[model samples]
Target: MIDMLVNLYELPDSSELYQRLEEQGIILRRANAYERHIVADWVGAHFSPKWVSEVKVAFSRQPITCFIATREKEVLGFACIETTAKGFYGPTGVGEDARGTGIGKALLFRSMEALKDNGYVYGVIGGVGPREFYQKTIGAIEIPNSDPGIYRDILPD
Candidate 1:
């Protein structure tokens, strides 16, 4: 549950991974504004309510900050950047049945590239779960004393 930092500029190119996903019929792209409700409902049922709320905010941004991997119109996975906080990469998840196809990596890299294009030198992955996955994928480094960094005051409804 530690926050991790990513050096956006240092990320390796993701085009190859993207192409692989494309070949497998998984399309990676920004989440459309009109698709927010469906995406949010999916997240709420599969992930968490907090993430669904944040994904809604991501859709509201002028330039949408959320990305998704879909196949034949079904949402396979999603990754959102700059949702909870500026320059923060998170709220990402892959469907249990749709994992191991490089979708998660594609989503992560795509979102990080977007942040880089937005001039972010570094991106924070707040309250991270898969530490090794982020580290192996994007060389993310742990931020000391960051457990519950921004979620310390989250109250139950």
Candidate 2:
């Protein structure tokens, strides 16, 4: 998987995405310190152990680098920034039941927006999975020869 780059200075507005998710009973907000363990466990169970580890670091950071999609107090999905790698956006997912509601798109744009607000002129979607999604959503471009760019030492499972 190659890394992809996003132009933080040219990101689309985020408030509109927030409003759209809110209308669907989805509350999009930063994960609070008190919710760290719960969120990390959820991510681990639903995603990967590596992602869980990165998410823990995100929670420890001041301002909380993780964002979550919740409905009625239950975690529906999550996205994290500046975790696993600096100036990077990733490790995000929606529950199987939560798919097809635009939740993923909202998470992607909103998290990249947070990176922009934090003074990043450009953000790396490190080791991208959905190439067309990134391309259509934010015009993310391939970082040539970035395969295993930062995960050159990833240990075998």
Best by TM-score: 1
Assess every candidate by TM-score. 0.97, 0.96
Residue by residue across 88-157, what tens digits does model 2's lDDT show?
9988999999999889999998898889889999999988998999999998999999998997888765
In candidate 2, what residue range of length 10 has the lowest lDDT sum?
11-20
Candidate 2 lands at a TM-score of 0.96
Error (Å) of candidate 1 at residue 97 is: 1.0
Off by over 4 Å in 1: none
lDDT of 1 by residue, 58-117 (tens): 999989888999999999999999888899988999999999999999998998899899
Q: Where does the lowest 10-residue lDDT sum fall in candidate 1? A: 148-157
